[model samples]
Each structure stands twice: as structure tokens, then as C-alpha cells.
Target: MQKKVPQIVFDSKKPENSGIEILTIESLASRKTEIIDHNPEKAHQVAFHMIVFYTQGESKQLVDFVWHPVKKNTIIHLSKGQINAFQFTKKLKGYILLFTETYLKNQINNSPKNEYLRLFNTHLFSPSIQVPQDSNIIRYFDLFYEEYNNHTEDLNQQNTYKSIYSIIFSKLEGLKQFQPFHLKQSKQVNIFLDFKALLELHFKASRNADFYAEKLNITYKHLNTVCKATVSITAKQFIDQFIVLEAKRLLINSDIKSTELAYSLGFEESTNFVKYFKKHTGFTPNNFKKNYL
Candidate 1:
């Protein structure tokens, strides 16, 4: 059995300081149908981007939107902060390739293709993409996996791997050029995504909508409009969501007491946190912990 992944941590240690862990299709190929029911309560931040090319599968991928009918030859982009879950039977089989965003940064710096750069760099504002199944694109994607696996043992492994990954992203970028659907303007999407980024950084400091708007240099009205346009929620709703999520994560994942957890999240008193959480989530923080954990 594959060992359970250790408690996910966001480590800032340099890459060379900690040897990278690489997973290959040939290694995970036979086990595609296995179910991985666990999810990170809070998505783990990764230095790399994840490209999951599904050749055969029947599963739902939760990205910016939910993707279902996961069949032969589908590709998905998973950027940071997109929480996901998986339920698979014996039919799932695919290649999941991960390499640092630094790889793409290097590509843009060297070759400087506008369309390619735009697609990979969308995470600054939008953090996920779901690509349609395309036969031609699938062929190139398979080549990427084959090329990486076949040349993995080279003396200059990192260099060879880099070349192979570059080729894969270059080919993948072509899909953007000839997409069947008109991809929505990503800038519109980023307004909300960047707001979420702000939430991650400041949820503990303040849960007020005006606080985010001030930092973003936009009026609270504009912030609320942007969030409502994208996610059908108000800015305050999003802020509350983040606070509640963080509250739950700390409550379940740590041994800290409820009152301390409340104080850590910026509540002056534990009772106030309890009242606030109950007002928003309809459950006291303690009850949420008892039921959910």
C-alpha cells in the first residue's frame, strides 16, 4: 500500500536543501483506481504547479468548477488554494506531473510567448483550470509522460527533466491558441482570486470587508460587486468563509484549546468568538469541533 502522505506542511527550505520527491506514471500507473478519500483541510501551498492528465477515469474533479465525466484524455490544471477530493474505482488512470512554477518562469523569461505566459501565470488572480479532452493534445501529453519516464535515468537528470517539462508546457500552451470555447477574460476572474489571496494573509487580522478593500485600493462597493459577480457572495461572506475555515482547520488539526484558538483568530474573548462563530455558522465553535472532527 502507498504510505499515507505525512501531515502536509508549507516548508520554505530551499529545493537543494531538501532533495525533491518525484512520482512517475510507471510507478503510480497500476494503482489509478485506488481511492484517496482524504483532503487537506486547508490546501497545501506548493512551489510547483500540478498537471493531471487523465487518460481513463470516472471521477469528479473540483476545480474552480466541478468537473465530472472524467474520461479518457482529459487534462486539468490545479494551482495553489484549490481544495479537492477524489473518489475512484478501478477505471481511473492518468499521469500527474508536477514541477515548480519556477520552471514556467524560466520559460517565459527565455522564450517569452505571450499566450503561454498568460495561461501559466493566471494563478496570480485565478487558481485553477479545467481543459477539455482533445485527441491531438492528449497525444502530446502522453509524449511528455513517456519522454520524462524514458529519460529519467540520464546523468544530467534535472536538465533533461527540465527540457522534457518545457516541451510539455509548450505543447500544452497550444490548446489555448485553438480552444473551442472562448476562455473568459482572466483579469475579471483575478479580482476575486486576489481577494482570496488577501484573505489568506489577513483573515486573522480582521474579518471586515472594508479592511480588504482598503488594502486592495478599491472601494468596498467595488470589492463586493466583484465577489458577487464571480461567486454569488458578498465580500463579507467571503471573509467569514475564510475565518470559519481557518477556525475549523485549527480546531481539528491542532491540540490548542478552544479559548486560545479564539484568541489566536483575533477575538478578544473566547465567548465572543463562540457567539460570532455561532452567528455565522449556526454552531458554536466547540460544537463544530465536536461534530466535524
Candidate 2:
């Protein structure tokens, strides 16, 4: 049987908070005893979005089995359903903000122009952002901390919370241009996101880009163009990466065997899946498991 990656809920909370919780990383690490049947040092998936801004020191954070080296002013965003783990002993100084999707929907500006608010879409942009000393990102974060922790509830303060979060995300999104990949046009990004949604729903049924393109009601060439423009990869390459990513996620988090996972992921024969996995990733499923585990 395949055991699942432990799925943590948005239950970690404080009495004063409603849908959001903000605390220092040091304080978060000290509550290891509060978690039952799970270790914070090991990989597990979360049901809520997370933001960790490193104000000082250095540490490595694990997301989807990949370890990211982080330093001062580095902020990482982890979305719902992504796997992550922390290095509690690394003397990192930061604040972690955890919020549910409902809270985010209320806070986010859904106006079509605000792509930077798409902070958790690791596919379009990198999950981590480096803040400059002169930037107000940290200042706004501090303001939010003070406001949220004030233990006061009123329509006015609630509106202030929304406004502060909006500024923080927009500022962070504006900083994404500093990353290696520049932002794509909104139309291109929207197309890729649509295709991604369909892929996630039907990836087990088909790995071919044509299947998704047809479902998206666009030409295969158009889909390829959209993917290349948005993520710098062909549509087919994107699908393959998604599959391999899912495979790696399962291999490390669950006790499922290689053949079992292959079938579960929709390979006609287990042997073909083995070859496909090795072709894209250097390691066979078992070898990848051994190293990560």
C-alpha cells in the first residue's frame, strides 16, 4: 500500500487570529512537541500557503524534495499542497505567515492586472524573492505583524490588514523582474495557467500536449508557443516535467514501489515508465528514493 505524505492543515493558530497566523521562525521551531506523529525536520505537505522572510542568519528550506539555500532578506512562498520541511537548528531569524485560501481570496486583488499577487505559482515565477535594503517590503511586513498581533478586531483594522498584504505582494511581484526569468504577458500567462489546470486534472489520462491543447480549445502550435513564452519550455516538455515532479513527490513521500507508482501515474507498462523516468531524471525511481530518504 502507498502511504501518503503527511498533509498538515491550517489548524496551527493563536486565539486572537482568525484565518491568518504570524510568528517568528524561532517561536515556530520551539513548538515541535505540539505536533503529534510528525517531525518538522522531515518532508510533509501543507494545506495552507506560507511566507517566510529571512531577516537575518541563513538556512536551507525544502520544498517538493528540493532544498533551497536562503540568506538574509530572502522570502520564500509555499502554496497549498506543496511539500516542505525546515532546518530548525540553523539559527535562522525570520517571520512566517500562514494563511488559508479563503483568507487569501479575501485579501487578493483579483483584478486581471495583478500578476505579482500570483506569488505562490512556482511554475510561473520562483518561490523565493530577494529583498533590497532600501525596499519597504520588510517595513510593511512589520506593520502587518504589529497590526495582526494587536489582538484588536474591527472593520477598520481588517481593511488595514488587507491593504498591507496587498502592498507586500505587489512589491514582491515587482521585484520578480530581478529574477533570471522575466515576466510574461498576461495573456500568455493565463493560457499556460489554463493548460496547467487541465493537465493536473487529466495528466493521469494523457501526457500528450495535444490532448490538453484540444481540451483548452487551442491549436497544438499555439499551446506550444504559449508554454515557451511563459515558462521557456515547449508544451510537451512542461507536461513531462509535471509528471516527473509528481513521481518524485510520491517516491520520496510515500512507501509505494516503483512499479506501483508507474501504473498509478498512467504508464501502460511499468518498464516504459522506468525508462521514461531515467531519461528525464538522471536517477531511476529507486535511486532517487535512496538519496532523498
Candidate 3:
């Protein structure tokens, strides 16, 4: 028999890297223990823009449904509401900068929209770039650390914060190099983006193809074709996947009994939820938690 993979839940409270709080930043730095067996039980939802800048470490970033490696100097940009995870390496060295999206928005509205956020979002899975230790990049970060250290000071507080956001954006744009995935979007891609947004919000309650088709104002056949063209999964499958993920989350993360879990998940009865879970996963809820939890 093949050895089963271990699915571990990373406790966020312990051994956290500090730079900025989830949606707020003022120059943060820390080293983390390896996160190999750990999986964050919930998606990190925040209004801030997060930049995980690693120096001498590696991490696997789970973005959407794909995992991407992040090595030194190359930053991973996670926009607000994007579901992502940080699986840290054993030897981790880096500063994680978490600033409100508003900070970047203010600068972009005044200046050119920063190219770094744009490029990074497009090429999220590409290989990392190593920044030279003695380079100006390191020197620039030193200044960031200094400013962050002085954040509590009253003098020039507003100006200092403004400058920080501007400097970071400028540095990211200066790294101009990007991968092929950074191409401008096509019409179909835009439509798919909208579809994904809808699915994220309504997947639990809307399980039928016609439900989404009516909302998108398209025929069911057209909706299925669009979903298949982009994601290769039918709309119903996408809905089921979302529901299943939620089921797994509730099962593993909560202390609630299975009967309650079923009802809360919108099942008409506890038995129905148990049956649905068994059909999809080949095991009952208790078995899943026993083996995987």
C-alpha cells in the first residue's frame, strides 16, 4: 500500500513571522520553522497587500489551486481576498511586509499603477530571483527596517508611511523581469474571472448549472461551455468542489458533531449530509477526520 500523505494544520499563533499584522505593515522581519507537514486550515482573507520577501529560505505558496516555489529576493504578492498559504522551509530568513491595499492604491492613483503587482500576479508560479546580498536592494531594505523601527515616533509619521509604500512599489517595478504568464487578458479570461468570483460567493447554495446561467444571464449550455473552456470542470463540479472544501474545513476545524455539521452545511437532514460526503469522498466524515485530521 502507498503511504498516505500527512495533512497537518499549522497553528498561526505559534512561531509567527512578524512584519506587519495581516492587513497592516511597518517593516516586519522574522525566521520561521519549516512548514512541511502543516496546512493552514482556513484561507487568509485580508484587506492588505502582502509581500513575502525571503532572503535565504524557500517556501511553497498555494495560490488558488496550484503550488508555486518561492525562493530568495523574489516576492509573492497576494491581493486582498485571494486564498493563499505559506508553507515555510526549515531554514527561513525573510521579512514579510503586510500593508493595506489602500496604501498602494493611494500611490497608484497618483502615479503610474505599479508594474510589480501586475507582473507578479500574472507570473505567480515562475521560479524565484536571487537578490545579491551587497546589492542596493539590500541597502534599500535596511532603510525600510530603520523606518519601521521608528514608526512610533510622532515626527513626520504620515510622510514616513507614505514614503514607505512608494519606495516598495518603486523597487518592485524596477525588477522589470517577468515570466510569460504576464500577458494581457483575453475576453474569455475576464469572463472566467467573473465566473470564479460568483462561484466563491454562491457555491454553497447554488449547485445547479442553471442557477449560475440565470445569474450570468446566459443559457445553461453556454455557461457549461465557458466553464469547461477555462477550468476544464463543469459548473456543477466547481460548485461541488467548493462545497466539499467547506465540508472538509468544518469537519477538521470545528468541534461540532457530525449531525450539526451536516445541518449547518445546508443539508435537509443529517443523514443526507453523511450520504453526500460518503458518495464524494469514499469515506464517512468520521473516517476522513480520523485518517486525515
Candidate 4:
């Protein structure tokens, strides 16, 4: 195994790709090795956001360690820092939309309040969205695909790319509301998002719910309330779940030892870390790695 999951970066300097890479799944298969140094069929972390819209055929995409079955009109979202693996087949057909973080931020800068948060909240929603065949999203994708293919200009030099991105995003935002357990725009959602931001930044420093609650300037009970409201779990459980998810990612993506992994995750004692891992996931770190990896 590698030291860590391979990080695939966007090549904006390529005029053909620019800040955005729009290509068919067939085209992606040909360029897979150029984008990822490791096996594209294996789980790898992406540095940019990716969306794959299947126009035909069927396949399963592993997103953040979950295998989601996808078919025609299915939109698979792979957010930044998320681990995704592809199961390629000659019969599958799709458009893989990839964009740089800078481009994404620029487009979302003008979005209404909490719109940006709702766009990529993979922590709350599943990574896949099924678009009904009759939906206008198909029309939007067709237009974008048609325009993108005929234009040889750098997308960074054109405003059409940005506008199309926002359009597709807004359309997907509407479809996302239909997903089970999808959170609506609310104060609790905002609180949960803020708490999640802090948790990501300081997860290694401390997994204590109170630490994040204090950082977010919200009481522990309030933080717990928001977490339960948003994710059906208490704040502490959410922190544990986050740690376990990270631990699982590291366990599968790397060959780091149990003791080393424990300290790296802020655990002072390896034994305690082992116990904690088993308590939350029902498997010790080594057992999880052995069973899953």
C-alpha cells in the first residue's frame, strides 16, 4: 500500500481542460492514468470536485468507501478530499465533470445564503442523486455538453462555463431536496455546518464535542441539538463518526501502523485508541484493516 491515498490534482494549465474538464467516460478511461498516478480503479482522494452524469449504461462508484449503484441519469458527486474508486466497463456511458476549487468558489461566491453549504454537504447526503428522465437537468447537460464540445477556448477565458456550472448546481440543489434526510435551510443546519467546519480543521487536535462547541461559540447542548437535528446523532457521536470515517480511510489507503495511527489522531495511548475504535466500529484498527483492506 502507499504511504497515503493518492491525491489527484486538477491541471488548469491545459487549455483543453482549463479549470474544468468535460469529457465522456470513454475519454476519461483513456486519460485516467495521466490524472491519477495510482490505479484509477482503486480508491483515491481527489483534490478537486467531480461529478459524473451517466447518460446511458450502469455501474457502481465507490464514494468515501460506499459503493453506490448508478444508472442512466444518475449523478455521482465526489467532493474534494473524498475517496472514490471507479468500476469501469466498456458499456458504460457518461460525462465526467471536473472543476478546480478556485472555479467552484468563484461561482458559488454569489450564491444565496447556505447555498454553497448545501451544494457539497456529502457528510449529510448520499454521494449519488438520481435525475428523473423528464427533468430539465437533462436539457441543461445537453446544452452544456453541446456547447463545451464545440468550443476550443480556455474555459477560464469564458463566462459561459461559470454560468453553466451555477445552472447545473442550482438544478441539482433542487433535486437534492428530494433525497431522504436532506436538511432544509435552517438555523440548525447552519450551526451543524459550522460545527462540521471546526471538526474538520481540529479533528486531529481534539475530538471532544465541547471543544468544537466552544470553538463555534455555541453551548455543548446546542451543538448536540444541531447535530441530532441535522444528522440524527449527538455532537459527540458525530465527532466519533468523523474520526472513525477518517480512520477507515487511512486504514484502507495506507500502511500506517496501529500505534502510529493512534498518536497521529491525538490518542495518547494506543490501547485506548484500539478500545475506542472497537467501541464505535466494532472492530479494532488492525482488525478493520485486515478485514476491509
Candidate 5:
């Protein structure tokens, strides 16, 4: 039987009034435990953006079946539709801020959309960052939480939250700037971004680099150049990496059969899927599943 991944929505206190919810680590853990206990196979695919600030204690979380360690001063940002499971200790202390894409889209200006994309949308980078506990990042989160709780229908109050949100992204941008191989805007960067967006849309049905290049209205050579310059990988490699990652996620988190998953992933034969998975990951799909389990 193919087990289904559960879709989780933000359980806001006033669902009709706001699309945001703020809860502490303890609260989130309790609620998450209850849900998982009721349905052990419920692998959550959240439909909203989540920003988690870990202020104390150590914990682990499975994001898309990858285990990430959480510690004091660790901040993890998860975009919509990513699967996550909480595995934190009782001593964990922090905040989990949840907000819908619609709310963020309506609030954030167009100027910072690229930065937003780099931070939130890009799967090439790790979604979590470790920073100083007393840094301005935590301060901005504190301000956002305070403003979120005090939210009103007043335009000024709403703008206040938007302003704080912008500041938070600014802080994230600053942190990213200091990291090695940070994203920079350029013609190649723009092309690569567009290619990534298109790949996400068409990867299942079409994995050809030329197909993506045509969609981007550029030559395959140009697309490859852009991808190599932006991320030090060929365009074909990028596509394969994305597909293999998705395959791993499914293999570990669901009970989808190999033949069915192969067809679903556009492979004409299960043997071809096995060969492709092994070529990229050095392990066949079944081996990878066994290792993961």
C-alpha cells in the first residue's frame, strides 16, 4: 500500500482574522506529538512558511527526511509544502512563527522578492542558519512576534508588521552575504533563477536541459553556462540532483512502490529508475530505502 503524506495547515487562533500563528517550541511539540501519535504515518507537508528560532537546548528535526540538528541560536526557515517532523526535547525553548504565502506576498514589496527567493525558495542552499544568540536576528524575530500578537485591522499597524518583516529579511540578507558563495544578482543569476522555477514546474514530465532552455527562450548552451556559473554545476546535473532528492524524499517518507514512483517520475521503466538513482547516489532505490529505514 502507498502511504500518503499528510498536509498540515497553520492552526491559527483566529483563522478568519489572520493567517499568522506564533507558538513556543514546547507548545508546537505538544501539538505535533498529539497529531503524530494519532496517525503514526502522518508525514506533514506544511502549507505555510515556518520560521523556527531555537534559543536553548538541542533538538533534531526531519525536513524532507533529512535530519537537521537544532541548537541554541539556530534559525531554520521552511517554505510551504516541505515535509517536517518535530523531534525536540522538553528542554527546548524558542518560537515557531507561521504565516501564509498570501500574507507575505501581500505585505512584502517587489524590490526584495529576489532576496526572498534566494532565502526561502532555493533548494540549493540549506534552509537553516546558525547565528549568535544575542544578534539582531533574534531581536527582529522578537519584534515581529510582538507586532503579530498586537495585530489590528488598522493600516498603520499592518504596515508596522510589514516593516518588521522587511527588516527580518534584511538581517537574513546580511548573514547570507558573509557566507561563502552567496547569491549575487547578475544576468546569469536571473537566467539560473528562471531555469530553477521552470524545472520545478516541469521536472516530473520533462528532464531535458534543452526543454528547459526552450522554455526560458535561451539556447541550451547559454542555460548550461548560466547554471555552471551560478552554482558550479551543469544544467543537467542540477535537474538530476533535484529529481534524485525528490526520489529520496518519497522513498524515505512514503510507501510508494518503486515501479509506481518510477512512472510517476516520468521514467518509462523501473530498471531505468534504479539505474539513474544508483548513478547519482551510488545506491539503488531499494538500498537507499533500507539504509534510510
Candidate 6:
């Protein structure tokens, strides 16, 4: 018997109200038992964006099967569709803001849509940022928290909240510019970004670099050159990394049988999938499952 991964949908029953919610880490920790009483060990696939700021205390969370440490003044963003589970201490203190895609599109109208896509879309790096407990960054979050809890439903209030939200991300983007691995703007970088988008859409059906190159209207050699220049990895390596990542996500988050998992990942034969997994990870499927699960 195979168990399915739990998919959590945002509460969309009230469209008139803003599609956003905010809570403090302390508040969430108090209700931890009530929240996880149903399935304590299951990782939830959230259907909304989660922005977490850790102002104090230390904890850890599993995002897409990778456990990230949460320290003071740290910010973590979890885009929609990522599997996550929390392990926080009782002293945790911070804010957790959950917003739906609708809220982003409707409320944050001042920023371009591509900016949102670039920030929220976690492909090349972990969607977490570390910052000194500077007053400027803290001020933006404080304003957002106050606005979120004000309980005002008027248009003017909504716009005010949206403005504060935009400022938070704007500052974060500025910090990202100084990151050592930040992708620079160039023709090669653009091609790599396009390749990643296409891979996300077609990885389940096609893992060939040539297919992606055709979709990008670029030659396979050019795609490989761009990938090597941008990330120091070849184009085919990028495809395999995406496939293996999804494989691990499924293996840890669900109870699907090995054969079914393999087939779902576009493998025609289960043995081939096992071999592929072993070649990349140096562990058989069963061994990997035993180690992680």
C-alpha cells in the first residue's frame, strides 16, 4: 500500500478578504501540538508562499528535503509547492507570513511580475537569507507585522500593507546583489535561466539536453557553454540534477512504491531508474530510502 504526499491548499473560501495571513513564531510554537496532531511525521506540500523571519532563537526546518538552520535575524522563503516540516524550540520568536499567489498579483502591483518570479523561484540556491540584526531591515518587517495584524479591510489599508511588503523584498534583493554566487546579467546567464524554466516544465517527460536546446532555439553546444560558464556545470548535468532532486523529494515525502515512483519520473523500467539513482547518488533506491526515511 502506497501513501500519498499531503498537499495543503491555502484557504481561498474568502475572496473578498486579502489572501494573506501572518503569525509569530512564538504563537505558532504554542499551537504546535494542535497543528501537527493529525500527521506528525508527514511533510506538507504547501500551495502558498511562506516568508519566515527569525528575529531570535534557533531552529531547523526541512525544505525540499534539505534541512536549513534557522538562527537569529535570518530570513527564509518557501515558494509554493515545496515540501516542508518545522522543528522549532519553544523560545522561537519571529514572524511567519503566508500569502497566496492571488494576493501577490493583486496587492503588490507596483513591482514587476518578473521581480517576484526571480525572488520566489528557488532553483539555483537555497531560498534563505542571513542578515545582521540591523534596524533598517527590522523596521520593514516590523511595519509589515503591524499592518498584517491591524484587521483593516479597506482598500487604502490593503495598499499600505502591499507597499510595506514590497519594501521588505526590495531590501532583500539589494542584499542578494552582494552574494558571492549571484548570477550576473549577460547573454549566457539569460540562456541558462531560460534553460532552467524549460527543464522545470519538461523534466518529467524529457531529460535530453537537445530537447531543451530546441525549445530555447539555441544550439546544444551553446547551451552547454552557457551552463558551464554560469554554474560550472554542463547542460546535461543540470537536467540530471533536477531529475535527482525530484526523485529524492518524492522518496522522502511519499510512500509510493519504487516501481511506481520510477514510472512517475518517466522511467520505462524500474531497474533502470534504480541504476540511475545509484550512479548519481552512490546508493540504491532502497538504501537511500532507508537512510532518509
User: Which should have the higher lDDT, number 3 or number 4?
Assistant: 4
Candidate 2 vs candidate 3, TM-score winner: 2
TM-score, every prediction: 0.65, 0.86, 0.60, 0.88, 0.82, 0.86
lDDT of 1 at 173: 63
Over 4 Å off in model 1, which ranges? 1-49, 61-69, 74-76, 80-85, 100-130, 151-160, 163-194, 278-293
Clashes of each: 0, 0, 1, 0, 0, 0
Best by TM-score: 4
- Our tally of clashes for model 3 stands at 1
Candidates 4 and 5 compared by lDDT, better number: 4
Candidate 1: the clashing residue pairs are none
RMSD of each: 6.1, 2.9, 7.6, 2.7, 3.4, 2.9
- Count of backbone collisions in candidate 2: 0
168: Cα error in model 5, Å: 1.8
Give me the displacement of residue 147 in model 5, in angstroms.
Answer: 3.8
CA shift of 88, model 5, Å: 1.0
Worst 10 residues of 4 by lDDT: 149-158
Residue 196 in model 4: shift from native, Å? 1.0
Q: What is the C-alpha lDDT of each candidate?
A: 0.59, 0.82, 0.57, 0.81, 0.77, 0.77
Which residue segments of model 6 deviate by more than 4 Å? 1-5, 12-16, 36-42, 107-109, 152-155
Candidate 4's C-alpha lDDT? 0.81
Candidate 4 lDDT by residue in tens digits, 129-189: 8887678887777777777766555535456766787788889888887777677888888
Write one digit per residue (lDDT tens) for candidate 6, span 139-243.
877887787667656668766767788887778766666556776467876778889988888887898999999999989999999988887899999889889
Give the 10-residue window scoring lowest on summed lDDT in candidate 2. Answer: 108-117
